[model samples]
Target chain A: MAENILTPEEIIKRGELVFKKTKLMTDNELSYCPGCGHGVAHRITMEVIEELGLEEKTIGVAPVGCSVLAYEFMNVDMQEAAHGRAPAVATGIKRVYPDKTVFTYQGDGDLAAIGTAETLHACNRGENITIIFINNGIYGMTGGQMAPTTLPGMKSSTSPYGRDINMMGHPLKITELIAMLPGTVYVTRQAVHKPGLVRKAKKAIKKAFELQQENKGTTFVEIVSNCNSGWKMTPVDANNWLDKHMLDYYPLGDLKG
Target chain B: MEDVKLMKGNEAVAEAAIRAGVDAYFGYPITPQSEVIEYLMAEEPHKRTGMVVLQAESELAAINMVYGAAACGKKVMTSSSSPGISLKQEGISYIAGSELPCLIVDVVRGGPGLGTIQPSQADYFQMVKGGGHGDYRLIVLAPSTVQEMADFVELGFELAFKYRNPALILSDGVIGQMMEKVVLPPQKERLGDEEIDKRYGSWATTGKKNGRERNIITSLELKPERQEAHNLHLQAKYKEISEKEVRLEKINCENPDYLFVAYGSSARICQKAIQLAEEKGIKAGLLRPITLWPFPSKEINKLAEQVKGILVVEMSAGQMVEDVKLAVNGKVKVEHFGRFGGMVHSPDEVLEALETKIIGG
Candidate 1:
């Protein structure tokens, strides 16, 4: 009963704050839609870097998508790459500043579609960097167009009649494909829909950055995310849908290390 | 001490990059300029000066890599041929819009599409008139010899960083492949991280130091008014470059009846053509533009006041001719002549073309 009677100022003065936002995140507001995973992804990433004590030495490359302005939210030195060229851009940064931690934040369309060559070559060359891939199955920023990772029968704007495997071809399992490349030292797939899953995804991101310090090769972390607005579903329904649908194809867990 | 060597233009560029203390070179090899990466790999500048050299999978990746390093306030560069350069335009535009400093060497060959591996100056328009999509200008340098090829590496970086813009070394296949004696500059040490921070701290993404806001290298300004302001700022920088960076060489223009305006290999041809014209008592002079974008427009325009006719020679059908004519503004008769599509015109043909195209017409 004494705790309940404590004043808010007194509780704060007693250093009883349960959780605080990481200073690595800037004051600017995030642009993600309500309940979008990008906000969580961005915070966990910034938290990981902060926890690792690499805040002052991290450089990030942001891709073209809903997270194109990742630089605005994440308070770190950053470069905005054209389309899917984030890996190549990170390669440039890491090579120049071998002591610094460099990573890329890219969307499914950026990583699996237009930027395939850059992503593959960066992985193939084993560039000592981290690639944070956000796979939402659909192109979120482009108004729900079918992405390279869109499900086989998923209905998107481009696949209005539903994706016909015979016509539109198969959805790419790029994370699996990336794990096979010898250049990648660690490759894992994760999600952040729930608090427990968010912690696991953050741990995976932290491990990827830790692996980058070893300078063995490329480390990739693919976060199987949802684009609720693009999916035309409510946030809660999207999470349930992702669990029932997306997880069946993109099972969560480490594929390589 | 100055180190001199006999080397191909492409090789000279590679060697010059090392000597200039470039921090990184990421490039994909292409015909007429493959020697750039080959020489860098063979020499291993990483061992010599701790510079990073990577042969990228494609020109697109190479240019983006250059963008990344440049955004970090490092001296970075990339080289490719015509077709490869075309693939790099997207990155180049992004770099320009971000206002990053880097060098792009284009050892151009003939092209509407992989047209030839031979020496050609057909890329004059593409290089001088903004090859990428944007309201941006690359400080274009035309190197006429293997020596200039080596020298411009330093000059390009200086100009690029001075204004925080991209600088292009525009050499055609002839100069790229030709062997000549070059006086390579002495090696300068690569800039250390602290030094880069000191010099480019205001804008470069050299990591956010304690007590500083994070640096963001980006071209995206979603707000229309802010984007317009950024564009205007870039245009202002370009105007300053055009006013101050015009480089040209005037040969025997004291009193000439006719003038020959050319650059790169075409300038070399016109030098000999001028001698032949003198032998014919034709009194011809040459105005060779060194900086093609911040063109020798002022010099050419002034010279047009004195000459009766001006002949613009290039390897293209008539690319730089438009710039030349614009400069002259009908003050004197201007005509264009050259062999193209992998063809090189002889000195005699240049003289004949000048006689027919400018005088006889």
Candidate 2:
């Protein structure tokens, strides 16, 4: 029996490669934990920017969270904003460089809680920018603290007895709220736990950027992510839990366009 | 021919910003400084120089907006009164730590917390002592006249970019509201895209083009050693600025037995006080600080050796007085006197305070 063999260069020359990382991403390793949705979110966002050939004209604002150093991975001109101020910062950049594509990557705590005012006002003002929000139900960077998105009965470091609705306040469905704002031309929620879902989430992100280019208004894409390390569960268990619980609360699909 | 205009201090600063070629102005309305945004809005600078004038949601948003623009190497600025300035401290610290060049104008009003809408120098400590967190220094310029208010808009941007540091034009409600004759500088064109690329391309977050690496504007350094190194670099820059940037004016100091240390509106009041003292045969001199942070410490110390006593005048209870005392260092007796919480001290009151506080007491 004769076995056919091909060199790596020949495989690339023949365009037979299965997958290649986007050049818009840097060589630096992602700071997210294994199986964490942040890595996927970062990858897809970069892939979208690469697909649109906006690597040179894009400026990204990174919020204070596990991805505070998103600038380290996203190979583009970037600014790290004070906690929850990414929307306002992105607004500033977009207004000054109306021709440049500007976007912000923020987590729930940085977007829905401490930065709620900035986020809402930026959206309300119809800023021509995109906001990539990651909702993981818990504060991943600050060690599993209960976040504004923490579901009822969810256990976190701050909520040792599991979240009580009355005491901890009900989970915020901020995506739906943002969709209602006139400034937001497009708003959607999607997950990245499965291969099929990751593709859909990538589509949403790409669409958001496209709308931003249209100068329509604020474009928001929420990635319902899982934080296994902060959730104190195995990656598989976290995905299972997110699918069973987080999905019911933050159902996937576009709320506005 | 000089374009001379009789304008209010706030209006002069606004006009000066347009002529100085500021790229953008992000501000929110606040007492004592509301004219800044109002004037900019009415002038429609976008038509004049393509400047982006935005009314932000709040002072916090305004300052952060400035942070974003400055990171891109744009000449951005913001203005607010004391209470509003308090809200911007966090963003100000971030801008300082990131070492981005921008201007912040504080048309100061009285305040421990919204104390009054009237002029006060209570923010002297806040401006010169690094109001926000971290070890950082703002290049503070105290403008005593509307001309200086107009002049400092250009000068502030110059020093801010020269050192890649945040520069503050510390005015007061009095100067901001008072009308004065100002020779506005000629309109210089704003920096074009190619100019910005040529000038700040190395560090500014102006698109990662021309095959260069992505530029990041952040103050975070997780590594302790690296953070320390960044702090050391900032300190060195500040030290160099202090050595090269101390600005002050000496009036009637050729020989004097009594001296006054003041800045901003207080400096103007002290000038009048100087005239009154001379009439009373006191032979008083005035030392006015133009740059409050590089402070006129060395000069004040030299003068302390000549004068019998020194009195620091400010609208605050006594903020800059502490710095004056530090400069005098016990060589001569130093005293402080001022009307607090929106009250303006008259020339008669200032001379009387000099006689009673330093001379008689």
On lDDT, the leading prediction is 2
Clashes of each: 0, 0
The RMSD of every model to the true structure, in order and in angstroms, is 2.0, 2.2
Q: Write the per-residue lDDT of candidate 1 for residues B151-227, one digit (tens) a residue.
A: 99999999999999999999999999989999989889998888889999999887788668889999999999999
The candidate maximizing DockQ is: 1
* A1-257: candidate 2 lDDT, tens digit per residue: 23468777878899897789988888998888998998889999999999998899999999799999999899999999999999989988888899899999999999999999999999999999999999999999989999999999999999989999999899999988899899999999999999999999999999999988889999999999999999999999999999999999999999998
Error of 2 at B34 (Å): 0.2
TM-score of chain A of each: 0.94, 0.94
Candidate 2 lands at a TM-score of: 0.98
DockQ values, each candidate: 0.86, 0.82
* Candidate 2, B1-361: lDDT as tens digits: 9899999999999999999999999999999989989999999999999999999999999999999999999999999999999999999999999999999999989888868998898998888998999999999999999999999999999999999999999999999999999999999999998899999999998899989989999999999999999999999999999999999999889999999999998988999999988888889999999999899899999999999999999999999999999999999999999997999999999999999998998
Model 2, residue B196: what's the lDDT? 96
